[model samples]
Target: MSTDCTTSSASTLTRRSLVLGIPLVAAACVSPGGGPAGPWRAMSYAEMYGPVVEGQYRIPAIDTTTINPAFLRSEVSWTGPEAAGTIVVDPKARYAYLVQPGGKALRYGVGVGREGFAWNGNARVGAKREWPKWFPPKEMIEREPRLEPYREGMDPGIQNPLGARALYLYEGQKDTLYRLHGTNEPKSIGTAASSGCIRLFNQDIIDLYARVEMNAPVVVRA
Candidate 1:
């Protein structure tokens, strides 16, 4: 995707600024639960929402009541070419699926790239970071001079646009500048509002981060 910042503020950069790297993995029949063997039980709204304390950082709980129900995390049937453990993003549907065994996927509502910023292709989760920093791309700074201060990078925290977790996507050895990351703007879920990256709720991202393995495949579909 081309350089574009979703917001004109200095605090965030266009989704094109996010990039990642990792090797590919073969397809496997892994359970959707991603844990002990058993029927996958869905997490209740209360169970999924709350303050998440990771190390010194405390991620505040999301007010699920304000969010659309369709955007909530849940498991759904999936029939895609990707293997289990692969991350499949359906931009038009505004949903992301973490493929699981038995024709199932852990589906999560997401905020996709805005019209002109959309991109699609295969990539891999090259790296992962917690409370990742934010750096406005050079082109973004040129367009919005107010972002000049963040040209170097912004410190990680709740205010950061990347939110609590980030899974960088790469194609072969090249950085695609796209990400499957947590978003500070939870309200943006189920909408096409980002510059190019895919956004998930903080709690959902944290859960996904724990289940996803390094070098997992990611397929973004337009």
Candidate 2:
């Protein structure tokens, strides 16, 4: 597999940005008084109609950066214990945990299934790609032939399905037929719905995608 961002195989994708030890840097571009310009209004109608995640996520923007902490779940914490493993996704709490030694975990607030359709159990991130070319599985093409054209590939840009990054999931060295990836849907950041893949704000995934390895174990919980 290529460590570089380019798609090695024809089946995968290449990220537009080469992630090479990039540090998270933020300057106080906003004037000191105006109550920080963040958590803007939801863009899509579905998300606007639906409930908001409050401070969990924010609408995507170029200049604005939405880097919220994971421990801000507030009243959404679960009764059950947190999973102990390499990775964990507490969908109910809308947080994903990357377990590490010394009892610390790298946690990130995530957008889960809308109406109880989230994926669970153990899986591995077999491959990682940037701006992945979305080849809708055969089942989708069968139902909607219009998508057949995408079987080839799509380049990186605003319209790309995989957004800024993608982390491919596999179950025991096999493709799980699912992906934990990013989406351009800014409104869908907090709530899940009719979207096909698990969507995250592009910046969030760019952070998450760089943290995990190619074969890291993932455990999604209810």
Candidate 3:
């Protein structure tokens, strides 16, 4: 069965409420040209985060200027224990890695859960959904009754907390009640802000969703 993390759909809860501290520069050594200074195609920031249209929703182009340049997607060296095709999330570093074959990984900036809400462990991608609906967890509804109205489920839209795609997490046969989903909040990237789920930008999530298959290994680190 599908479960919910701590995120809510209440409009009253502004971005300011979600952010706790200044933006963390996890990729301090990354170059200013939109990604790590390496042998890349030299794609401009505009092309990487341009607007996209899926089904009927038109995802707005991200304003790269406003966000930390290091948070943008890039291919970087990988020395983790996991093999290729594994998904590894470093919540403390606000980054997610999709391990590739050549001792490299495609890294994306992420927004993670706040202090007490963060969780980490081994899990797998149990399922994938495009334009997925969102169901507020019981606890979140209790904290903000406004979300109760969406108890049934929130429709898929650009503003939906789940954004364009969602990868449901599971451990063996049990749902972990966590996800690696997309968010419309570009500013949330590189910050500890979400309730429990790992969030990527819409463009990044769409890219990740297409590459990740069902049952892909996932390791979320504390």
Candidate 4:
């Protein structure tokens, strides 16, 4: 039940299309010190998809070949201000980094908000959920009346826009109305197509969801 961006209306760009349309740069292509480039070549489908569980909802395997190698998950050197375990999102670079202890980070490609939809600031992972239900915001519904049917909420499943996991961001006591979540569209990994939320591949989100803890610091840079 995954929604296809192709079928979306041209007059009103859906959030899904926004998240998928941003161009991914090859900033990390050379790798540090001219080392072996493109870590994705060394990764296998099994490693990218992991094992399946019976009865549990599972994300469909993505054809890694269809994705840009730059968007593939890999460890990269991070010299940012965030501390270990912090999630730093560089919307301009279309990359998200989970800072590690040794000047390194688990880097994953992300789809961020478009020009006007984008925001920069600090927030905390106030909540996390797996296969979370989706409640289209009033603004989204107004732009795309077709989503009116889902005003109540869409149930958790593979077809759901939230994909396999969602990490809610909060600024102190108030919800930022933003999220770091999985997308059904893997091709969106290196784009600026989302309305405002940050999106990751489903497999990447699962990996991120496991390492991120409640109240983890998240810094989104414009």
- Model 2 segments more than 4 A misplaced: 1-85, 142-146, 194-196
Model 1 Cα lDDT, one tens digit per residue, 1-222: 122233222322212111110112213212235421224343445445445665666666677889887778777787887888899999999999888887878888899998877889999999899788877677667876877888888788777878888898889987777888888778888998887889898777776776688889999986
Could you tell which candidate, 2 or 4, scores higher by lDDT? 4
lDDT by residue (tens digit), candidate 2, 1-222: 000111122211122211221112223211111001212221221221122121323223422234333321111222334433355776776666655444445455566665634566778888888666766666655665776676565565446766667777787877775677766654555555523345665655664676676687777775
TM-score of each: 0.82, 0.60, 0.82, 0.79
The CA lDDT of each predicted structure is 0.71, 0.49, 0.75, 0.71
Q: Give the per-residue Cα lDDT of candidate 1 at 118.
A: 82
> Against the hidden true structure, what lDDT does model 2 obtain?
0.49
Give the Cα-based TM-score of candidate 4 against the true structure: 0.79
Stretch of 10 with least lDDT, candidate 2? 29-38
Q: lDDT tens string, model 4, 56-134?
A: 5755667777878888777788788788879999999999988877687878899988767787899999999988899
Which pairs clash (backbone N, Cα, C closer than 3 Å) in model 3?
A: none
- Any idea how many clashes model 2 has? 0
Q: Which candidate is the best by TM-score?
A: 3
Q: What order do candidates take by TM-score, descending?
A: 3, 1, 4, 2
In candidate 3, stretches whose alpha carbon ends up further than 4 angstroms from where it belongs are 1-42
Clash count (model 3, backbone only): 0
